[model samples]
Target chain A: MADLALGKESSDFKKGLQAGISIGIGYFPIALTFGLLAKTSGLSIYETVLMSLIVFAGASQYISLSLIAYGTGIFEIILTTFIVNIRHFLMSTSLNEKCEEDQLISKLIYSFGITDETFSVVATKEGTASTGFLFGVISVSYTSWVVFSGVGHLIGANLPQTLQDSMAVALYAMFIGLLVPSMKNNVKVIVLAVFGAIFNSIFTIGHIMAQGWSIVTATLLSAILIESAEVIKAKYRGAGHEK
Target chain B: MRSEIVWMIVGMGLVTYIPRMLPFVLFKGKELPPFIQGVLKNVPYATLGALIFPAIIFIQKDDIWYGILGAAAAFIAAFLGANVIVVVLGSIAVLALYSYLL
Candidate 1:
């Protein structure tokens, strides 16, 4: 009986890993670009890979390259990355309901591996998600991110100087890669991007604060403005319907 | 290793880790306020926007047009729901071409 259960668990893990294969592939270029950009930003290869190993958040890790380029302070970089990742709080909260009952330690380990992609894949499974499956999914994804990040950094560091400098453009390309998919789906995303950029530029030109802080401040203000507008619009429609 | 960089890496790790793990650990059987959920949902758009908008236009100081072209390629590729790696390589391909042509 125990042997049967173990076989079932192993199969579940293999299935979860199969599900994550696409996500792992998706992470490759993003993580690679992050590594390249980090090298361009003067990070040691160790520093570049270590960031991925530890932080393991894509956009935030990529954003840190720009922050480093800007000569932003360490504290500001951490703070900015934190704000960028704030959405994970919501993702995790929703995922809690879907996660199967397990030891607190199991939850702790796999939760650390959660990224937006893993969350979506695991959360959308047909029924309650097993802790073993969660580990299988995120472990593959996590390994891809960290390992390819190192691969990118090593490849980047070996490139000639001119090519290395040009790779800096990859950072903005990375950001656009992130932004466009969402904007295509939600018009509100377009507004947020348009205004957020305008606001951050104003702050940059005005010299109101450091660049890292400017991004953080502009993002918060834009999100708040748009979110409030949306809520108010929904309220207005509801009231109008009542009339 | 510089002390500051070490601190920064560890700090960023904590920031990302906490948000991911906190809810699973702390909210075993609870729900959060609707307002907070609403805000969190928008965080990605707001944050990605703030990172990209004005900045993408200026990523390359010498030839701004290359940056613009790169953005266009990435935007289109992602808009079509191409895999994220493909979206990135698509932009890189464009940027590389612009460099060669110009």
Candidate 2:
């Protein structure tokens, strides 16, 4: 019985690896750009690669690079990173339901691998995602993210000065790219983004706060304002139905 | 300077790990309140928006179009439902060409 179970586990692991291929491939350019950006932003190759190795969250890492460039304080950067990654809470909770019951250690091990892409893949799988399978999926995606990051840094070092200067815009382009699709799908997202941008501009231009604090404040305020509006709208709709 | 970067990365790693791990370890089968969930859901979009603006225009101080045009390319690609990689690559391609022409 043990032998049979081991065989099944191996097969499940293989399946997970196969499933992760697309995510791994998708990560190539993004991770590479992140590495390049880190270098351009004045991070040492060691620091750049270490950030990828440790943090492993894409948007937060990118944001950190920006904050670092602005000479933001360490504590502020960390707080901003927390705010950016707060959505992971929801993803992790939802994934917990989809994943199989396992030892706490096992759950802990695999949870580290959960990202937006990995969560979607695992949560959407037809059956409960086994621990081995989660490992399989994360292994591929993690390897690509870490490896390509280093590669990008190396490439950045070799690029001409002019191209390097222009590459600075790619980070913002990446953010716009990520936001546009969700904005198209949900009007609320558009409102949230616009509000966030407007508030951030006001704060930044007025010099009311440091750059890091400005972003953190803008994000929290916009989220709260937009979601409260949504809730109020929903309540009014309910009232209208009752009337 | 090096130590500061290390501490920052460590701090980031902690904050990041907490969110991804706490729910798995602590919550057996519970859901957050609807309002909290709604706020959390909007956080990413809000954060993204905040990150882009103000900063985008300042990317190339000498030539604002450098930033605007790159953002336009990314917006178009993303609007067409391209994946993250394509959107990034598309913007890069556009900016590379723009720079080359200049």
Candidate 3:
């Protein structure tokens, strides 16, 4: 029985890695740019690769580059990384529900590999997510991100100074690339983002908080407000449907 | 200065690491309440929006319009559900053109 189970697990891992191929491909460009930007922002090769290896969160790492460029303090960067990656807490919890039981160590190691893309693919796999499968998926995606990041830094090192400077604009465009899809899919998302941006702008203009804090505070406040409105609206919709 | 950079990365790693690992350790078999789940689902959109909007408005200090053009390209590609890499490339292509023409 154990042999059969082990064979099933190994096959699932292979399938998961196969599924993760597209995700690994997807990560390459983003991770590469992150490496390039990290170089532009004055991070050492070790620092750039290490950031991807350790933090492994895309948008937060990009945001940290901007913060570093802005000469923000270390504490603020750490705090921002925390707040930006806060969603992972939720992602892990959700995946835990779908994932089959395994060793605690397996959970510990694989949980670190959870990102938005990995979580989505695993969750939608049309079966109970096995530990072997989850490990397989994360393994490929994590490796692509770390490896491409270094490649990008190397590429960045060779680019002309002029083009390197121009690459700065790509940062904002990248964020928009990540954002607009979600906004189009949901009205509530659009409102939440707009309000958060507006609030962030006010905080920026008012000198109300440091740059990092301003983004953090605006996000928290906007999330609470928009989500409260959503919950209330959902209640009304539920009531109306009942009638 | 470089030492400070290393420490920051390590620090960021810790905070980032904890969140990803904690729930697996703590919430292994338990399901969260529906209300909490709803909030968690909404987090990315909310966070992404806030992160994108005002920052998009201020990209190039001198050439705000330049920033808008790149943003428009990103918006169109992403809204159409182009793959993420395509979305990024679309924006980069537009920006490269905009920079070259101007």
True contacts kept of each: 0.62, 0.72, 0.60
Q: Which tens-of-lDDT digit does each residue in A1-243 have in candidate 3?
A: 999999998998998887676567657767888998999998988999988998898978999999999999999999988887776776676677778988999888988888767765675465589988998889888999999999999887445533543455454555555566566656777887788788888888788876556665776777778778877877878865642
The best-first sequence of candidates by TM-score reads: 3, 2, 1
Report the C-alpha lDDT of model 1 over A161-229, residue by residue, as the tens digit: 345444555545555655666666668878877777888889887899766567667767777788799
Off by over 4 Å in 1: A1-52, A55-107, A110-156, A160-185, A238-243, B1-16, B23-30
Give Cα-based local distance difference scores for all models.
Answer: 0.74, 0.80, 0.75
Which residue window of length 10 is worst by lDDT in model 1 chain B? B36-45
Q: Assess the local accuracy of residue A100 in candidate 2 as a C-alpha lDDT between 0 and 100.
A: 80
Which structure is stronger by TM-score: 2 or 3?
3
- Rank by lDDT (best first): 2, 3, 1
lDDT, residue A184, candidate 2: 71
Worst 10 residues of 2 chain A by lDDT: A157-166
TM-score of candidate 2 chain B vs. the reference: 0.67
Tens digit of per-residue lDDT, candidate 2, span A10-110:
99899889877756765776788898999999998899889998999998999999998899999999999898787677667667766788889998888
Flag the better candidate by lDDT, 2 or 3.
Answer: 2
Residue A162 CA displacement from its true place in model 1, Å: 6.6
Q: State the C-alpha RMSD over the true interface residues for candidate 3, after superposing those residues.
A: 4.6
